[model samples]
Target chain A: MIRFDRVSKRYPPGVDALSDISFEVAEREMVLVSGHSGAGKSTLLKLIAAVEKSTGGAVLVGGQNVSGLARAALPYLRRRIGMVFQDQKLLFDRNAFENVMLPLSITGFPRREAAQRVRAALDKVGLSSREKALPVMLSGGEQQRLAIARAVVGRPKLLLADEPTAHLDADTAADVARIFKEFNHVGVTVLIATYAGDLFPGARRLQLEHGKLLP
Target chain B: MTAWLAQHGDAVRLAMRRLASAPVNSLLYLLAIGVALALPAGGQMLLANALSLAGTTSAVPHISVFMAANADRGMAAEIESRLKKRGDIKRVQFLPREETLARMKANPGLRDVIEALAANPFPDAFVLAVADERPEAMERLAVELRQLPRVEHVQLDSAWVRRLDALLQLGRTAVLVLGVLLSAGLIAISFSIIRMQVLTHRTEIEVSGLLGATDGFIRRPFLYYGLLLGLGGGIVAWLLVGAAALWLRAPLGELVRLYDLTLVLQTPGTRDSALLLAFAAGLGWLGAIISLQQHLRKS
Candidate 1:
C-alpha cells in the first residue's frame, strides 16, 4: 500500500525529477508507472521505497510517512518491500542460489526454511537449473530471473521493480511479466516502473511526462 | 537464541572464507601483528623474571653496622648490645673482625688478596635484621646507627634491592609503553585491512543495504575478520614467546649461575595467554568498528 501526497523531488541545480506527484495504490493492487526515459518513473518508485527522499510533500507506505522515518527505521520499512533496480544489483561473486538467499539471510530466516524458500522462488522464476551458476556466467534473461527470485524470496508484501524487462527478448519479458502477475494474483502489492507499458496492459497505469503526472 | 547463534555462526563462517580466499595476505598480516606483540610480551616476561629474582634476594631487610677500623671488640660488643635493645631491630649478629677475615680467606679469589695484607683490615660489625623494610625507616635507622660511638659506617643492605626494584619498575613502564604503541599499530593495521576488504566488497555491501540489511548485519563479517586476525596473531605471539623462553632457558640459567642467583625463564602461563588474545582481539574489533563507521557514513 503506497500513497504520495503532491510529492516533488528536485535534484541539484534546480532539476525537477518529479513534480506535484500525487497517487495512491490500495493493498494487493498492481500498478504500472509508465514514463519516458528520465521522466520520473524511477524517482516515484524510489520515493515509495524510501531509497530517495522527496524535496517536498510526504510519501507514505503502509500508513507510515517514510520521508520522516529515522535512518535506523528505514531498514524495517525496506524489509517489508522488495526492490528490483534497473541495473539488476545482483552480487556477481555469489551463485544464483546464494544471491537469492541474501534477503532471507538479512531477515535471519532459519537456514533450512530459507533454503527451501529460495529454491521455491527460483523455481517460480524458472531459474532452478542455474542455481549454482554465478551472475557473470548466466545469460541476460537468467540474470533477470535470478534478480526476481532474490526480490521475491523473502515474500515481501510490496514489490517495486524498475525496468525489470529492459534488455529481455519479448518472450522472456512476457515470462517476467507473468511472474509479477502471478505474485500479484496471490495478493502481493506490485508497482512496476517501465517505459514499455504494453508489456503490462490492463493494469492501472500512471503516466508521467516532464516530471508531471498525466491523468 | 538458536537463530541468533545461527546468524553469528554464519557471519563467522563467511569471515573465515573471505580470509581463506587471501591466505598469503592474511598470513602476512597475522605475522606482522605477532611480531609487534611479541616484542612487548617478551619484555614483560623478562621483567617478571627480574622482579622475581629481586623478591627472592631481598625477602628480609638487613642493616650492617661496622665498627671503626681502630675500634676494638669492646666497641663492637657495645654497639651490638645497643642495636639489640632497640624495638625496630629484629635480630643482631655480632661478626668479629677475625671471623670476617676468615670468611674472606675461604673464598679462592680473595685468598691471595687477603694473604697480601699485613694485618686484618676487616672491622668488627653488627648485622641487624630490621622489623620495618620501608626505605625511609631503614635509612633513618642506618643514620641512627652511624652516630653510635666508634661506628665507622652503617650499610643498609636493602639499598641495592631498592635500586633493583626501581630499575625493574622502569623496565615494566617501558614494556607498557611498547605494548601501547604496538597495540596502536595493530589497530591501524586492522583498520587498513578492513578498509580494503570493504572496498572490494563495495557492490555486495550496497546490494545488501538495499535489500534491507541492517548496519549490524553489514558490519558483522568485517568485525569477525578483524577478530580472527587478532586471535591468530595472539596465537603466533604466544608461540614465539614460548619458543624464545625455551631457547633461552639453558643459557639464562648458566648466566645466573655465575651470579649465584637461580632464575628459570617461565613461558607465558594460561591466564596471560588468554589476556593477550583478548586484548589483541579487542583492538582489532575496535579498528573494524571505526572503519565501518567511516565507510558507512561516507557511503
Candidate 2:
C-alpha cells in the first residue's frame, strides 16, 4: 500500500514541481499515470521511490513513513519499492544477467541465490535467452524488459515505472504493460507514469496536468 | 542480507568485476600512489640509519672550564663539587695546570714551547661529563658553570655533538612536514582515482540505485578500491625503504670499520611496519570518506 497525502514538492527559490496532492495506491493493483511533459509524473515516482523527499506532507509505503527516513536508510526504503526508468540505466560494461543481479547485491544476498533469482526474473520478463547480452546489443523493447527484470528481482512490494514503454513499438508496449499487470495480480502494486497514447484499459488511470491530477 | 552472504555472492562478485572493468586506470592509480608513498618513506629510512650510526659511536660529551689567574684552589674545588652534586650531571674532574701542560708536552715537538713558559700559564680547569649526550642539558650545565665567580672561561667540546643533534632535529622536522604533505598528496591521489571510477561507472551507480541499492551497497567496491591502492602504496614504500637500507649497509659498515666501531643500520622495526600498515588502512579509509562524500551527494 502507498499513500501520498497533500504532498507538495518545491525546488529552491519556490518553484513547485508538485503541489497539494493526495493519492492512494491499493495493494496488488496496477495504476497508469498519464501526463504530458513537465506534468510531475517523474517527481511523483521519485517521491514514492524515496529518491527525493517531498517538500511537504507524508509519503507512506508499506505502512512505513518514508518522508522521515534518514538518507543512509533511504536505500532500505527503496529496496521494498522497485523503480524502472525510461532509460534502462544498465551498466554498459556488464552483461544482462549481471544487470538484473544488481538489486539483489544491494541487499547482500549471496551469489548462488542471486543467480537463481536473476534467472527467474529474466525468465519472467521473457529475456531468459538474452542474459549474456549487453544493453547496447539488446533491442529497445528488450532493454526495457531487462530494466523491469532488474526492478522485480528484489520481489519488492511496490514497483514505480517512469515511461517504461516510451520508446517501444505498440505491440512491445502492450507486452510490457501485460508484465506489470501480471506482477500486480501476484500481489505487487505497480505504478506506471507515461504520456504514451496506449493505456492498459483494465488498470486504474490517473491523468495529470501541470502537476495536478484531474478526477 | 549480510546473513544471506551465500545467497547474494554472485552479485557481489559482479560488483567487483564491474570495478575491475578498467584495468588500465586501476593500475595507473596503484603505481601513482605507490610512488608518492615511497619517496618520503625512503627519506625517513636514510635519516634513521644515519642517527643509528652517530649514536653507537659512543663518543664522550664534555665541557672544559678554565680558572682565572688569581683564582685559588679552594674556589675551583667548590665549583667542581657543586657540578658533581647536580643530578643533571654525570661526572666532573678537576685538572691542574701542570697536568694540562704535561699532557700537551707529551707531543714530540712541544718540549721547547713548554720550557719557554717560565711558569704554568695555563690555569686549572674542570672537565665535565653529562648523563646523556644531549644539547639542552649540556647547554644548561655550561650556563650554570659560567655563573661561578672564579671561572674565567667555559669552553664546551660541542662540535660533533651539536652537529649530530642538529641533523636529528632536522630529520624530525622533515618527517613532520613531509608526513603532512604526503598525507595531503595521498588524499588527492585517492580522490582522483575514485572520481574517475565514479565518472566511468556513473550509469552503473544510477542503475543500482534505481534498482534499490543503498548508498552503502553502492559504496562498497569503491571503498575496496581505495583500500587496495592505499595498501599497495604502503607496501611499495616499505619495499623501497628496505632496499635502500640493504644497499647502504655494506658501505656504512665499511666506513665504521675504519674507526673500529660496530653499528647496524636502524631500519624501521616490526613495530614500525605495523604502524605503516595502520597508516595504509587510515589512508584508504580517509580516501573512501572523501569519495563517498562526492558520490553520495549526487546519488
Candidate 3:
C-alpha cells in the first residue's frame, strides 16, 4: 500500500519535478501511471522507493513515512519494494541467471534456495533455457523480461516499473501486462509507468501532466 | 549465525572471481604492495641481526681499573679478587705491569716505543667484564672502582658503545618512518584500484541499490578484495625477505666467524609473518572502506 499527501519534489535552479501530488493505492491493487516525458512519474516512483527525498509533504509506503526516513533505514525500506528502470540496468558481465538472482542474493537466501528460486523466476519470465546467456546475448524483449524477473524474484510487497515495455513489440508488451496481472492477483501491489494507456485494459489508470495529477 | 557465515562465504567467492577476472591488473597491484612492504620488513630483519651481532662481539662494554704505578702486585691481586666477588662482574683478570709491557712489546710497531721508555710505565690493572654492558651500568662500576685506595684511574669503554647505540637508534627510526610512508602509499594504491572497480560496476551498483541491496551487501566483495590484495602483498614481501636472507646467510656466517662473534641470519618468524599479513590486510580493508564511502555517497 502507498499513500502520497501533497508530495512535491523540486530540483535546483527553479525546476519542479513533482508538485503537490496526492494519490493512494490499496493493497494488491494494480495501477498504471500514464504520463508524458517530464511528467514526474519517475520522481513519484523514486519517492516511494526512498531513492530520493520529497521536497514537501509526506510519502508513505507500507504505512511508514518514506520522506522522513533515515539514511541508515533506507535499505530496509527498499528491501520490500521492487523497482525497474527503462535502461534495463542488467549487468552484462554475468549470465542471465546471475542477473535474475541479484535480488534474492541481496537478501542472503541460501545457495540451493536461491538457485531454485532463480530457476523458477527465469522460467516464469520465459528465460529458463537462456539462463547461461549473457545480457548482451539476449534480445531486447528477453532483456526486459529478465529485468521483470529480477524485480519480482525477491517477492517484494510492491513493484514499480518505469516504461518496462517501451522497446518491446505489441505481443511482448501484452505478455508483460499479463505478468503484471498475474502478480497483482497474488496480492502484490503493482504500479507501472508508461505512456501507452491501452497496454493494461480494465486496470486503474492515474494520469499525470506536468507534475500534477489530472482529474 | 550460519546464514551470516554463508553470506561471507559467498562474498569471498565472489571477490575471488572478480579478482580473477582481471589477473594481470591484480597481480600488478599485488606486486606494488609487496615491494612497498618488503623494504621495511627486510630492513628490520637485517637490522635485528646486525644489532644482535653488535651485542655479541668485542663491542661488549666493560671497564678497566688501572692501579698506581707504584702499587704492588699484591694490591692488583686484591682488587681483582674483590671485583670477582661482585655479581655484576662477569669476569675479572689481573694484568701485572711486567706482563702488560711484555704484551705491548709483542706488537711489532709498538716494540721500539715500548723499549724507549725509561721505566715500564704500564701500571697494574684489572680488566672486568660486566654482566650488564649498558653505559650506565659500566659507569656505575667505574665509579665504584675509582673509590678504591690503590686505583689510579677507572676507564669505562662507554663512548664507542654510546655511539653505536645512537646509530642503531637512528636506523630503527628510519625503518619506522619508511614503514609508515610505504604503508600509506600502499593504502592509496589499493584505494585507487577499488575506486576503479566501483566505477566499472557503477550501473550494477545503482541497480542493486534500487533492488533494496544494503550498503554493506554492496561493499562486501570489495572489502574482501582489499583483504586479499593485502594478504597477497604480505606473502610476497615475506618471500622476498626470506629469499634475501637465504642468499646472505652463508656469507654473513663467514663474516660473523671472522669477527669472532656468534650471530645467525634469519627470515621472519611465524609471529612476524602473521603481523605483516594482518597489517597489509588491514590497510587493504581501510582503503576499500574509504573508496566505498565516496562511491556509495554518490549512488
DockQ for all models, in order?
A: 0.84, 0.49, 0.71
* Candidate rank order under TM-score: 1, 3, 2
Ranking the candidates on lDDT from highest down gives 1, 3, 2
True contacts kept of each: 0.79, 0.77, 0.77
Better of 1 and 3 by lDDT: 1
Tens-digit per-residue lDDT, B1-299, candidate 2 = 45455433443464456446767866666677767776677667767766777777755878888999778888878877887888877777889887888898888798788889878778989887877667777787788878889889998787787788788899878887887788789988887777777887777777677666666667777776676678777887787778777877788888878888775665677877667766875796588779879865674
Best by TM-score: 1
User: Which residue runs of candidate 1 sit more than 4 Å off their true CA positions?
Assistant: B112-119
Interface RMSD of each: 0.7, 2.6, 1.2
Quick one: ranking by DockQ, best first? 1, 3, 2
The residue ranges of model 2 lying beyond 4 angstroms of the native Cα positions read A6-21, A35-38, A52-59, A63-70, A195-199, B1-20, B60-159, B249-268
Q: Candidate 3, residues B194-284: lDDT per residue as tens digits?
A: 9998988888888878887788888998999999988888888999999999998999898878867766798887887888899999999
Model 1 per-residue lDDT tens digits across residues A66-163: 99889898888889988888999999878999999999888899999999999999999988898999999998888888888898998999999999
> After best superposition, candidate 3 residue B11: deviation in angstroms?
2.0
- The digit string of per-residue lDDT tens for model 3 on A24-138 reads 9999898999889989888888889988899998999888999899877887888798777778889999899999888877888887988999999889889999999999999
Judged by DockQ cut-offs, the docking class of candidate 1 is high
The candidate with the higher DockQ, 1 or 3, is 1
Give me candidate 3's TM-score against the actual structure.
0.91
Greater TM-score among 1 and 3 belongs to 1
Interface RMSD of 3: 1.2
- RMSD of every prediction: 1.7, 5.1, 2.9
